[model samples]
Target: MPERTSYDAVIVGGGHNGLVAAAYLARAGRSVLVLERLDHTGGAAVSTRAFAGVDARLSRYSYLVSLLPPKIVRDLGLRFAVRKRTVSSYTPAVRAGRPTGLLVGGGEARTRESFAELTGSEREFAAWQGFYGTTRRLAERVFPTLTEPLPTRAALRAAVDDDATWHALFERPLGELVEETFTDDLVRGVVLTDALIGTFAAAHDPSLRQNRCFLYHVIGGGTGDWDVPLGGMGALTDALAEAARGAGAEIVTDCAVTGLATDGRAAEVTCARGTIGARRVLVNASPRELAHLLGEDPPPPAEGAQLKVNMLLTRLPRLRDSRVDPREAFAGTFHVAEGYGQLERSYQQAASGELPAAPPSEIYCHSLTDPSILGADLVRRGYQTLTLFGLHAPARLFTADNDATRERLLAATLAELDTHLAEPLADCLARDADGRPCIEAKSPLDLDAELGLPGGNIFHRELAFPYADPEDGQGGGAPARWGVATGHPNVLLCGAGAVRGGGVSGIPGHNAAMAVLEEG
Candidate 1:
């Protein structure tokens, strides 16, 4: 064994959440260590040199940013290191069979302009305002407090009693809810897109609580607009690494964590590098991956398998006959949803175990927004860059069943773009696979089965842990019996899998830190 190094806590993955947890623990004067499987940190939240000189991010995988909490950004002093920009979705009206306009944050003036264009005059805008307001309140009041201590038993009961006041609202499908609110197809599509992103739910799934997860971005404050972190998503991770080092947390890259060594009191983590002992080990890898490392059931609880594919494009996709202005080109997210029918079919195809033939893609053009991408020489080389993110089809579709599938997916995206964009996507520089992520090809599905997780679920346990069963101690925002502290007395869980749902938010780590401080 190498000279054993002891620490207060050892975070397993160096993703944004892991880094956040490390920083919080170190700030409290505790020795912390972070281990990353890849050569660099940030897990899925990263930027790499996919092409020479052109630093691009796997935007197609885990793209978009509004879900992160503002408190973490301000508290971590990541204001300068990681920043946000305004981005919205633009879809051509007639080209894709119908018009799809889902714009997120241009300004007060632009908001008015967009509202006037919608079918309804006063009633439609008023309803949108109501939905946005309600969604914002839910995110701000409910989500930020997710990691905090649960309410008392009586409080929990009372909250549920009150919740019954809007039983129909909670029970109805998000699509139904949106339809009841707006009359215009464009406006309806815009609002409903919120519920559909990252979700495999059918457009008419009655159980979908898009307001629960989707609203987190619409009104969680700090300019509800989505933007790319400067340089690449990598800059955000690099800043986290910098913060971890600054706060006295030791970080080792190119080291993969294989298993947990639990002594019933503390955990001794087994890694490719060796054993790392810590009072508590926070896992930042997806819940699925953590489960794999633990060697238990796959993908914990209710979350389904996460299949991601990313591609680097040579030419920027030029939307034909798009309503979005050229100046606001890179300021919004782009989607290929033509209407509700198309959206429903996409989900059905994925659910049926087959990939979508005409996959819906989420596009982000880094070269269009970031000035650093326009550096000399590379600009001369016509090195325009963008990311095309879409659904993962059947794994069987790949060449090696894995290798060729990635290429096929990328090729399909270019073919789709070629049909609409100004110039066909050309330069094929790099590709990343989220199913088999990092250098070792450690997949989320493999992680879930190894860990005790239910379905290779990555959101940890399930998204509805607190809201689902009343018998569970977490009912109505009440903490689990485990609370922030782990089953082991000396250990604590400070990763996204811990609480408040998932995202780049540091709530799990921040909450765990408070518990440790209180325990001391």
Candidate 2:
């Protein structure tokens, strides 16, 4: 028997974006086939029983949900859902030789008190409210346009309506805005963390890369709130796969795409199983992967900066600050050594080819919000999961020896975390069936090799502002209305590389499907 040799659309890579495209195109009555290299459909968005014999299922690579739009959910009839955290974030600090922390949820009054206590003034708290108020407006105006076409820089500026905000976010370095807006170093760092999640940049970088990262984080669903998926990250991908299949799209796993060819009207994709032809090809891989498949030279390389660690804890560790409960603090992002000055120093160290003496990181406990990820037995036993994202640890750091650097960096990171804990983090470790600590760490290099993320960049490349650049159409055809256009008319980028793409949002996938439909 032979597999089908053709489809109306052949999508390479089976990540959530690819799944979205398949569902839309299939629903539109186009024959769609999705090819995934891995045995599973989910790319980095997966849930796994990480430790041997562990009953807890952890969102291994990419966790949390903030960018996915409700429109996509309704349009696809997805069964996925997310729960908002009661606490936004908790940053532990030692003030006036007293162990204290700034907690940013519960209520406006409580957060204000924490801010006042930290700086001995309410100035920063007022600034926090004002800065966020401005961003909130910007988010509302800009987020709605993502699923539509890409707007020119001038149009987007006019759409934003506020010249000050447009310039602050689009034109100037994010660091300058943060420093000018917030007086407290810790508060400034808290605001800045949103800009540096998977990005490697200083606040003052002239390129404004941090600003681009900051926009996506703050504009999620127009609220900037990062919610926890009811299941693990895999659940979202699973729902996407279901929607796609139900819409009559064929999904084939373990089928690696080797090459792609197009003649401006039709395309052929070579995969491990066989070659398939299509009228249009939608790429769910990165720009580099797309170029390689098309036999074209890739652009300048991009490197991701972050260290990821997942742990199954016997119990949540106690915080140095006794006022806030561990559950409340861990439920939201737990900031460690991420003071404004500390973050800058760490970035400088990493840029100069050395590991940050004290790495900036954040921890989150998904179980507190949704216990379904853990087995009933583990839940009854008070076991929980903690995911750590360490900043300033780029792919370059582990190029020489990924294995050794991971161990050293993991140890140092945990040790730094221990300094702010009542007991060492190791004390809360849950042992697996084989007597091994139920824990794992991944550096940028590890993620690259495992997930095929070029240079370990999660967003595929440095994120560009959602709007079209001034040079967008200089190559002479109409500007990419959907931001998914490629050199060949029959091919389109449906991944994070697309304009207004990045995060778990399905904007690119939706836009790609729209492009194909409009062309047809």
What TM-score would each prediction reach against the true structure?
A: 0.79, 0.98
Report the lDDT tens digits of candidate 2 across residue range 427-463. 9999999999999999888887888788889999878
| Top-TM-score structure, candidate number | 2
Candidate 1 Cα errors over 4 Å, as ranges: 1-4, 52-60, 79-87, 95-105, 108-123, 151-170, 206-211, 288-317, 322-327, 379-383, 391-400, 403-419, 426-461, 465-492
Worst 10 residues of 2 by lDDT: 470-479
Q: lDDT tens digits, residues 1-520, model 1?
A: 5654777888887777778878877878999888887787776566555433344443323455654666767777773343455545555444246433445556756665666654436666677787766655444444444455755435533444535323423455667767777786656766666654444466566555454445444534433556565666666767777887898888998888889867645778888767778877776655555556667655424543333444444334455546665335534556554345665676677677565666666565666666463446555555555555453333333314454555555555556655555454453343233322111121234334443233434445534422334443332211243244443455455555564545555666666666655655
> Candidate 2: misplaced stretches above 4 Å?
470-479
Tell me the lDDT of model 1 at 37. 77
Residue pairs with clashing backbones, model 2: none
